[model samples]
Target: MLSLAGWSVLIQASLAAIPSYVMQCAYLPGKILDGVDRVNRNFLWGSSDSAKKVNWVGWDKVTKSKEERGLRLHSAKGRNIALLAKLNWRFQIESEALWVKVLKMKYSIKRGRDIFNKGSRWLVGKDSGLNVWHSNWTNGGSLRKLIHGPITQEASFLEVKDIMLDTGWDWGKIPFEISLEIKRMIQAIPVTILSRGAGKLIWAGSPQGTFDLRSAYRLAMGNNMVFNKKNRNSSLALEIVRQALEYYHCVASPRLQTCKVLKGIRWERLPQGWMKLNTDGSANGNPGLAGCGGVIRNDAGQWVVGFSKCIDITSSFVAELWGLREGLILCCNLYITSLEIELDAKVIVDILNKPAYVNNIISPILDDCRLLASRIPQIRVKHCFRQANRCADSLARMSVSLDSVFSSFHSSPVDLLDVFEDDFNGVNVNKLCPEPDVPL
Candidate 1:
């Protein structure tokens, strides 16, 4: 049997010797990932089975950095994205490469078309490639979808710069008449002062102007950083701590040098006499195989119940709304008078809280949720950071994997024990802050 030191050396050697190109291009199959995980487990403790040898710290914990309360070991998924991001970076800097030229030729930017293409979207710097109607350079999707009328022949093939006067947009320069809605959309599309170059295409999901593994992994994992006005105080506190740490080197240790103590968010229990309900939904593709899950806990922080259910093909937003609706129904059945529903989707919360808002797509489900909520003596729907809703998040992921249409856990499942413990103790996990801007 290999000694503990031998195992450590072997694991390090395996990581160091792995081919970078394979990491960049290869998406490992489930079987390969399972085999790799087994290898990693065997090397970590000289045994594949956790029953035979204790892993002192969990594998997930080991993969995270110190600031995240982990051992700094890289995750397979993270390493994959990190390595792939290098390819994305290469595309940006090596524009003259033969591969780059081929890609550019194959994926030329057309006006109004391919706006929602999978890979990346062009940023409007000089706006040469952007179209006033079709391109997603402005807000999100195509502007043509928002407009009720066609553009004039004079407006055809016109670049974004044509409507610009010096630093800002010249509304009067537009060839065709514009509506208030069009004006609002045009104004929403920001025209940042271009320092150099005629706009370049960038990954739409990425917040950083440059490619990075962390952002890629978040996109892969379906994690989103939900923001709200209530979180401003925490954001401010985090910024202060960051600035203080920047000026004071005395407090920094070697570990701190490698991993800064970033401000993290934690889960808080509901107020006295209130029950907290966290609901989440998952879909393989946006409208693919979808599922919903929810967990409820009393004010004292004890788990009441948790449920997961497979839903037919639906968008994630609809699935999320359905999850809340189901959770509300469950709460109503239990005769819970005071309830607080927490969801990660801000759009749904905004709609539910709005008395006059009406969405044709979600109206039926929204009506059911509101009706159930109204029956409860005290009820409210609030948006929360996904980090604080791990139990429901776990259940949502499980919903896709399970064969059954629905399942409920009267007691916490083994897989959920850690999440439940963290929730109970107010320990934070998976807290994501917004990405900082790249230097111009």
Candidate 2:
């Protein structure tokens, strides 16, 4: 019933109109659009379900504008793309639109990010990464308030890059104008000039320097900079304490692990041809008035030799080393061939058993003790509890009143007679942790 021009008009006004309208709202699958195109082709060519005719122009060319010398037809795919692009442009331009506000709320930084900014700090990987006074590096706060007086013109724009050296921190770049406390705190932080590029910012609120909302909230609620600083300080202190405890457990626990009750412990007499030497050291305070005492005994549990030396103010470690060294020297002088050494200090016992660590103050004494021990034909060093070492402890405590640097007693002193007799009798006392009336 329809001619070619009439078929074309019918296809445009009816068949293409429906899909073009749908394309403006949403994309139509390519296969569905292709089926519509097939129908349009069949209609234009006067083909029907009964028979088919050749399609003269490809659908692509048919869909081109009239200037391209083909029937102008709406492309379902093209219409979908143009609609989407227009919508996107509109949303961007209309700043006060509902969708724009919704997106801003979803993605934009709010007050939470401000608190996050306060918690962020620069980790130094490269020299130029941080501005000295402007950056948050020292104690999770800046050096702005800590610095005293007017900042010099040349130093106004000072950066971490200018003050670091290959060897370490450049002390020369440090301003003498700042307080000594500020200088000390700055020097305490290590800087390496080994890395390249501006270092990244890290969240100082977390232990790993990662950003988290929990720490940010706490930091935000903090009263002021000092409050925030205290929080950071407490975190740092906890970490340091954990590390110290680990080191102590590794070095001391093995030697010091003791029975809570003294009923499980007692001093014993040495075997024939063996000499037992008990040594102890005491400090009024760890680094205050210190002293060392040692007593050597025979198989009969009779005192062979006893000595006490008043060491000047020093650490308990140095004082313990002093006692052991003196005992070894006494044995070497007397040519006591077979000997067993006992000390109540686990730390000293640990030091003796392991290879000596290099210490500026304690190494010399430690080295002497090792050398003297090696000279003997036989030696055994062990850790003993305070209950087993009472005589030597009492003697060490007595050194606090001694005027002489060193003193020796051939006979058991009257003050330590009870402790000496108790040892000879293998007496035991009730020494326990949470020890009442007993030193920890």
Candidate 3:
């Protein structure tokens, strides 16, 4: 067996013989030393000039400097190899192929106690406890026995510590840790405030200030900046505060506003404890063969009322707004208390929330809808995904058929041929109303 000194020399020689590329690839900048530091002191001690001479010592110095400055320096070739290894590990786990067995074996060897325990005890015994009389019996011998098991628990503990130190997983000295902690604290504050339903307290900014806050929040979150300085037109700290406030406002207030132009009105009862009013309208050409429909339902999933009408409308947007107004009016007429109005128009929703004072045709109509909504108790308007409103959309399309129109308000169900006798000519309206083949 090689003497301790001989073993140390052999280890140093092996490290020295390692290709520069291999060393660069395997070298993790912040990993703690094993027993090789004394023999390979040159690894830490840097050279003066690195660009001209490819010295391992110089590379180590540059890496340390970059890390101290909160910058990461990576060798292209080294990163590629590391990335490949990571991908390979992921592939093995996901694919669960034969290679996964090999990977698990490798991971066991690297992370398992038995293999690494023997190496660690060997190194520690030959170095730290070498000179003690009972060192072998106490520290070294005990450690050897402790690490000798196939599934040595002590080895796992040491391996975990080694990995943590290698990866700089400890948060003790990292500058980013403080910043991250502060961010988390700030984010947590808004969430806590919002959870308590404190909207008025949170949105207590002046009217102009509220607008500014809204604008700033929109720009920041929409553009994906946690603390936007240029768009916020304020200090970085204030920007972050504004973002938090906006987030709080969104979570606390779930009320939605309706479009101003739709003409049809209808109501429906949802399974949940709330009333749903659906309105839809269509225009052929800039207000041509336009049609609108509305449905009202109460919280008990019962159809409260339904309406469909073909109107000589101007635009699709106008029809949509009219549908909203009709729905709201129906809710008021029925004395329904808690209401949720849903539409698919995003523009109408935004316009209702923040009405512009400019000379726009839709302004007055939108303001009217907003005013009407404010008078009602617990009325919310929301944008629904199109898929959710297919029933209402079908009714709107059905209303445009002339035969379906005059058959309206018949205390009895009227046959399709009775309403438009001339148009039907001999075709059956019942056959035409073919069970809307698609599932709702």
Scored by TM-score, the top model is: 2
Each candidate's number of clashing pairs is: 1, 0, 24
Give the TM-score of each candidate. Answer: 0.40, 0.41, 0.31
RMSD (Å) per prediction: 22.6, 26.8, 27.8
Lowest summed-lDDT stretch of 10 residues in model 2? 223-232
lDDT of 3 by residue, 1-440 (tens): 65534533554356433433443224333232222332243332321334232333433333222213211222222333333333332442355677666666665322212211211111111112232121222212332333323533433233212212221233342222234332222111111100122111101112211112222222222222212212334256766787999999988996575334322222223456678876676777653556667666556544567666654434677667766765666677777778888776776666666646331233333444766677678877777555445445655666667565311221211332232222213222221112334577
Candidate that beats the other on lDDT, 1 or 2, i.e. the better one:
2
Which residue pairs of candidate 1 clash? 112-134
Residue 341, model 3: Cα distance from true site in angstroms: 0.6
What lDDT tens digits, residue by residue, belong to model 2 across residues 1-440?
A: 77766777888789877765565345567898678777887777767899877887887777654433456665554444444333333333466899778866775423233454565655554446577887777653788867657777777777887876653456577555666556545543333322355554555545444444334433443424322423333356667887999999888766754445335468988789999999988888755678889999998899989999877565576678888878888898899889999999997888788874543224446666878899999999988889899888988899879877689999899998988988888777655643245566
Clash pairs (backbone) in predicted model 2 = none
Candidates 2 and 3 compared by TM-score, better number:
2
List lDDT for all candidates, in order: 0.66, 0.68, 0.42
Ranking by lDDT: 2, 1, 3
Rank candidates by TM-score, best first.
2, 1, 3
Between prediction 1 and prediction 3, which has the larger TM-score?
Answer: 1
Q: Could you tell me how far off, in angstroms, the CA of residue 218 lies in candidate 3 after the best superposition? A: 35
Indicate the worst ten consecutive residues by lDDT in candidate 3: 186-195
